[model samples]
Target: MSQIISGLGGQSLYGGLNGINSSSAIISNTQFNNPLESTVDYSALIRVLVTILQQLLSQSSDNTTRPTPTVADTSNNSQPFNRSNNFNTASNNNLLSAASNQNSEDDRNIDFNILSATQRDQLGMTPRERAILHLWGRQVISAGKQDGGIYTNVLGADGTGTNWANKAEVELVKELRAAEKQQFGGDTGIFLDQLYFNLVKEKTGVDMSTRYANRPVHFSSGAVSIITDINLLHQRTGLTEFEQGALRLFGHDPLINGKFDGSVLDYTISNNNALDGSRNSSGNPIDKVVRQLLNEDIQDDGQRNGSSLMKSVITILDRLYSSN
Candidate 1:
């Protein structure tokens, strides 16, 4: 019987499915030493193999354009990363103008509580944005309920809080930690700050860090609730219009659009199954929203242009918040 043996250095492999003792299976090195032997096209063979390997690599790669990473200067590495130049002068001026005009309108006799679509249009906002503002206002009024209450309460004189307020920041921090783990494989402890900044840029195409520099890291349920309070939103700082829109639509809007199965207001948070393709499960509304938003960029890069549903919502909100 013929045995398969390891060849010496510089010897090529030779084997075949023949009789166990067949000499035809044995390839002698002397075959190549023969001067009359014809030469094989080794270069052509190599090129063909290389081409196959390259085609395989191309096939395995995801057929989508990945999102471009935003690079910020981390000069003061000692302290937590606090970015500068969060937004451009144009957006800042527009926000300031809108806020100022909205405040002035509030001072007038016409009640915002009863403002119609026409009235909102006169204020330079779309019906959808106006609806979001009104819904947000109602949520603020129901602050003691499951969705929690206002965090800053700039509009209210008492500045009272819901049962969820005391733990809102803590809960938000926990939510971010979990999201960081799921999205990027680990929590950076600075995920919230960085994400908030990114959201600002995504929404307004400007960097806006100073507005939220001293703001508390924890976000209230209202910040993530589907229904938001327009008056309370105006009173608060730190959050950009884009971030606010994301909170409004994350998991909260499914019911409004007939997409969510359960109750409209989910009081007790559970596993938060929104981003995991299981939308029925309950958890902190804010957490679910954050996960849903961040997961869009993490899962596939091709859809990044419209990455999260929040991106579309933010575009609408921007027009509402704009001077035009």
Candidate 2:
């Protein structure tokens, strides 16, 4: 039995159990002889075998629970967790930011001060009043440029052969004529005021007629001259003296030495040209004239000094008469 144990490398097993000196020696010395005749310590052998089994079980448990080391994947195929979701989130954020910025820019571009009723009140004018002045100015300028009879009546001798109107007025008249041609009713008698009001409503969403129930309506008459019509307009509208004068300048040719030489329209256009060229310089007569007309403070600098309403009117005039 000892020879059989030696052949099975039992010595090596005993060498592995180094700390159990007594068990190692006993295990090494135990011999299994013939079962019927030999005296064998089965209990000592049982104790050594139990100790070996316990140590083997402990080693197996340690191996089973031990954590394994891992290396990070650096291959091209590797991607972050939730990679697609993360990319979509970032892209949506960028688009939202861009849209917000664009909306802010658009808001800045629109002049809210001009559109707001409360702001217009601060300038001592209602929106309807402002719209009336704008309409009258535009019409007078437009009528001043018409050919033949209408031109002669509106601007007098000054309208004889001169093309004193701006490009916008010319284009406006062209468009109006085109629209008139397409009308179902024939020859509606040159309703420029209607066209002007229609444009104002379309652009601003404010119907001038609704705002001022008694607003003027344009009508053609051979009995009344343009001057008589304008005087009646001032009386009916209760316009200030300055407002009346401004309207007259557009509708009438100014008399020099009791004879008409040049209209206020002529001087206004010339002065506007000078003002445009020398915007930073001072002492243009038209600037002083406008300030006086609006009863605004006059400054030496070329920069405009007026109430908000005054500034707005001047800005409209500038745009209407500008060569560029």
Candidate 3:
């Protein structure tokens, strides 16, 4: 597990504190001499870690209703923790109204089932999407990252993002819109755009005007690397299904430009203007973790930065174990 956190071949993916030593060498010139013992069993590893967190969360609470453990919203809400009553049902039913209420009764028992691969597809998420949800939730809950629980963080506060789908899922909606644009033209594409905008605003209380107003809502700088890979592979041949999916997930269209749209290039003027600012509206908690992992070099400020995903994950595990 530490290998996963610290990374292999002396490349310390799990960096240290913020101010320890910014200039210290994190990796050596050993080259690829130390290959991994074997490919990491991501599925099994994630399940074990998530299960441990679930057990700890369950044990910590004495609620009569048996609330499901959820991620807290990091933006807009100042509360340390936001709870989801159950994952089987939408935590924010108000967002979905009849849609979630109607479906929740049927899906209410499906929350715990998400850990199983067989049940995963039934939840309408791709492997990557579910993996992001599982790993991010585990990082937040079990790792004790200050972003807190699943309900507010990953799901989006008031269940706007989490209602029926998550931030990852919302991102997929944008991709779907992009696909519709390619297939139907700009008018139809804008229709889909409005559809999602209304849905997100109606349910989650977030609007793009507000979300992107102060801070540019780029998922992470990692998308730049991903887009480069996609453009390179796409020019060679038709993309693989997974690759195509990645393109959509990142809001890119091969049919259009090899480069990303202005939507993708939206940059923040300052920390105050950024979506993570004091008034962030649509920053996804899971996306934050994913971005951190994908972004380059966490050691710039050294070990003092508690925001590092490695430190966050380690802190979560430590808290759960100590509490037990």
Question: lDDT of each structure?
Answer: 0.35, 0.35, 0.31
Candidates in order, TM-scores: namely 0.21, 0.25, 0.18
Which candidate would rank higher by lDDT, 2 or 3? 2
Model 3: CA > 4 A from native:
1-187, 209-228, 233-324
Across 1-324, the per-residue lDDT of candidate 3 in tens digits comes to 343432332232233222212111222212334457555445754654455445445544533366453332312222322232233233322212321222222122222222344343433334544433333333222222211222233334343454534455455444543454465542122233344334335433546334322321111111111122334434533343232222222321100111111111111112222222213323223233334433412453443222233333333334432342
Instruction: Give the C-alpha lDDT of model 1.
Output: 0.35
Worst 10 residues of 2 by lDDT: 253-262
The clash count of every prediction, one per candidate, is 14, 0, 29
Q: Whole-model lDDT, candidate 2?
A: 0.35
Residue by residue across 40-105, what tens digits does model 2's lDDT show? 778867776677667655555655655553111211112222212122222322222222232221
- Candidate 2: the clashing residue pairs are none
Residue-level lDDT of model 1, residues 1-324, one tens digit each, is: 112221211222232222322222332211344446746344743554455445445544534467663111111122111122122322222322332243321111222223434443454444443333333433322331112223223212333333332233434445554575576554332354444445445434545345334433233432433324434554443344435435444434322212221121121122222221123222223445444444664564644332455454445434432311
Candidate 2 TM-score to native: 0.25
Give the candidate order by descending TM-score: 2, 1, 3
lDDT of 2 at 278: 19
